[model samples]
Target: MSARTTPSPARTAAFLTAYDALLARWPVQVEHLTVRTPHGTTRINACGPSDGRPLVLLHGGGATSTMWFANVAAWTAAGHRVLAPDLIGDPGRSVHDGAPLAGVPGLLGWLDAVLDQLGLPRADFCGHSYGGWIALEYALHAPARVGRLALLDPTQCFAGFRPDYLLHALPLFLPRRTAARARAYLDWEAGDGPRPDPGWREVYALGYADFPATRVVTGPRPGLDRLRSLTTPTLALFAEHSRTHHAPRVAEAARRALPEATVAVLPGLSHHHLPMAGAAEINARLTGFLAAPRG
Candidate 1:
């Protein structure tokens, strides 16, 4: 599928600048930690202090730990520990010797090793897009270890695919430079600026450049049965204008799957805006959900 094109030069430039600044003043000090999984010692980026309740932030496909840059400070300020790890095969700092786990089981295994190394008895898990899928899988497989689960506009709930993925994939058949330009254009569209730290663009661009095909594809079409069985309290936050307009259906499916889960569609935000444009709202919702007494 050909990449969808959008017109927004000013917005694109602003996003690029903001991203660049973020790279310069990276708030979180990152360390290269190793998790001894059955596959091998998977390298991951661990951040945040050891005093607060551990909150793991998992980034989406093609994105790194920086994806959660907008939320880390707020979460930390709220007295919750944050750990943002770059998905194994992605562009960020995580090292992948062979092909990392492709589906849900592999993702859970990697996360299990990470938690074991950190000595976290149980922690809250938050995932966006593909990361959300991994988070759901982890909670299902290890319900006892997940204090709370939060998913932000995750894929797989609806059978629709994002246009950006199609665009990124199209470049494979084109020349390297053309593919690079195509990716840059798509990245600009995905990012929302007019905010903080202009250096984020360079970091995102580098990540995209380094790992163009970092997406993890699911094995088969698994129904929502597993998600329904989750005993942990779940919060599924849907962006108002997500590419997949199936929020209502997704929420319904989640409700049917896990009757205890709460669903809310965030207003005045698109899929790309949840982390950037709707940071405050996202943080507030998360804080409230985590603070609520368990069922």
Candidate 2:
């Protein structure tokens, strides 16, 4: 099967350039890895000691594993081995020859293949945005494979995307998306920061430019009933200023539904850049949760 959405050659080249440049700046040495699964070959960047407890990182839509570049050291510093995977279809090195939106079964299958290939029976999971949604589904589908779960301003899980956020991002779908327009949209989404490095910003723009909106993976919103029954330990982080969802409502839903969950609303963060913006705070909360003893 061909990819539901494939980047044009030009945009792909540009994104790869920025991606390489960004990865080169990672604070710690990382091992590039690939795992072959039934769905496709998954590309991963591994860090920290081999024998350390496993921690898997998943990036959001229109981004690659590079999303975790700012927080890898914090996770690794906590004596955990980190594995950040470039999710299958959204503008990464991962190959997606099958339908990108195969719903829960397809996603769980791919994740299971990755874990099996890496010899990890269970690992702590931290996901941002779309990655968070994937992590949630994986935990529900194969509860045995997920040890602890952390969601960084995840979208389409506990709450739907905010209307204004959706309206503001509409320009991204225009056939003639330009770098300037894309960057502006990104800046608007990020709201505040030491503006991401120029190269990284361009990479974000090119990645979005290359990816067709139709193929973006928005995981199923398994209702509150299913969420209430989850047994996995979970940490749900929402951005106070996010346009992805009403932060308080999402947090409320998380608190109300998940049996074992801690919901926090990080102040002054937007949906797109929550992971990268408050890296220190986010990492602390994430590693702390992951390090806690399981019941």
Top lDDT prediction, candidate number: 2
lDDT (10s digit) by residue, model 1, range 27-104: 666555666655345555455666888898877765566667667777777778788776665545455554456566
Residue range 1-295, candidate 2, lDDT tens digits: 2245555667578778888988887899999999988777789999999999999998887668887778999888889999999887667788775545475577777888899999999999988888899999888888888889898888888878778888987887778767777799878876654465576677778777665545454555989778877899999999887766889998998888884788899897777778777888998998889878978
Instruction: Give the clashing residue pairs of candidate 2, or none.
Output: none
RMSD of 1: 6.9
Segments of candidate 1 deviating more than 4 angstroms: 1-48, 98-103, 162-201, 212-215
List the candidate 2 regions with Cα displacement exceeding 4 Å.
Answer: 1-11, 98-101, 192-194, 211-214
TM-score of each: 0.77, 0.92
Candidate 2 whole-model C-alpha lDDT, 0 to 1: 0.81
lDDT of each: 0.65, 0.81
